[model samples]
Target: MRSTMTNLWHPVIGIQISDLGEKRFMFKFFHRMGLERVIKGSPWTFNNHLLMLYLLNEGEDPLRVPLILVVFLVQIHGVPQGFFTEALAHQLGGFLETFFGV
Candidate 1:
């Protein structure tokens, strides 16, 4: 005895599941956290603070110039270790370098 069967099926509709990936999800998270504004404001504030310190220490505290510069550098370079990721920190540093010629 022998039995044979043949069947074929296909779905007429489809579904899509969004992955969103890491970067998009991070962007959405930052947007939700309201950190985008801080990210935008950070470099400006950092630079202005440095400029003020430079002006205040011009003659009286000339020795503090290097210290102030070092602090600025630490803040710029340490963004990753603080709150920002490596990529964001690098981008922020680049923006500051471009704007401040530092």
Candidate 2:
């Protein structure tokens, strides 16, 4: 799994993956850009199962943090000509979860 992800991401500096047991793994990136890139491309999956990811702060316990968030690319088509806007997209997204961007 680690090898596949490493190849998929192709981290510039490098990445360290540690198995934290109970189907949980922690990914450590050597560069902030690498981490950002991975995060921006969230909601990753492997072998048809969703991979939930959460950022771990310095003192937090990896196993204890809530990992309930998942990103989805929703396509809303055929709206009124005047209805498409960034604010509207955010409002619609907020109905499902916290909006990240338009």
Candidate 3:
């Protein structure tokens, strides 16, 4: 039963989701219900949000510096959780750790 599934977002007109298997339908549900929260807005899902938070923000409050950097990364690069995501994360995170004491 091999199916050539090309498009991943599964976007049914208004439903755009990642195929990464994170109960994303649930995320969509919660988002519709206003239960899925986002302190910073992006097209990324909850899993990607957490990954970016850990790698970019390190789970800090307010996220003054990292927020800007994260936003910059998002604007310039694609979702930080997708392909080649780690290189960007590691480079920025390592730089922050080395100089800014982040």
Candidate 4:
């Protein structure tokens, strides 16, 4: 998992992944951009299963934090001309939950 993720992310500064047991892993990124990129690119999967992620605060326990929420990028096909707009994207995203971006 570590090797695959390291190769996938390819962080500039580097990253350290620690096994926290119970199928939990802590990812420490040396660069802020890397961290943001990872978080923004959410709903990651491993071994055909969903990989949950959360940003840990100082002194926060990885085992205690809730990993419930995840962002999804939904693809829509065959839109009518002039119907494809930011507002339409927001409406579509709202159907799922919150609309962060188009």
What lDDT would each prediction earn against the true structure?
A: 0.34, 0.86, 0.36, 0.85
Q: Tell me which of candidates 2 and 4 scores higher on TM-score.
A: 2
Per-model TM-score versus the true fold: 0.23, 0.73, 0.19, 0.73
Each candidate: how many clashes? 0, 0, 0, 0
In model 1, the runs with Cα more than 4 Å from the true position are: 1-70, 73-83
Judge candidate 2 at residue 36 and give its lDDT.
92
- Tens-place lDDT digits, model 3, residues 34-90: 322332333343324433322223463333333333333423455545555668778
Error of 2 at 1 (Å): 0.5
Q: What is the lDDT of residue 51 in candidate 1?
A: 20
RMSD of each: 24.9, 4.9, 15.4, 4.6
Model 2 Cα shift for residue 21 (angstroms) = 1.0
Pairs of residues clashing in candidate 1: none
Runs of candidate 4 exceeding 4 Å displacement: 79-102
Full-model lDDT, candidate 3: 0.36
- Candidate 1, residues 18-83, lDDT tens digits: the string is 233331111112132233332333333222342222222225534333432423444444333467
Model 3 ranges off by over 4 Å = 1-84
Full-model lDDT, candidate 4: 0.85
Q: Considering lDDT, where higher is better, how would the candidates rank from best to worst? A: 2, 4, 3, 1
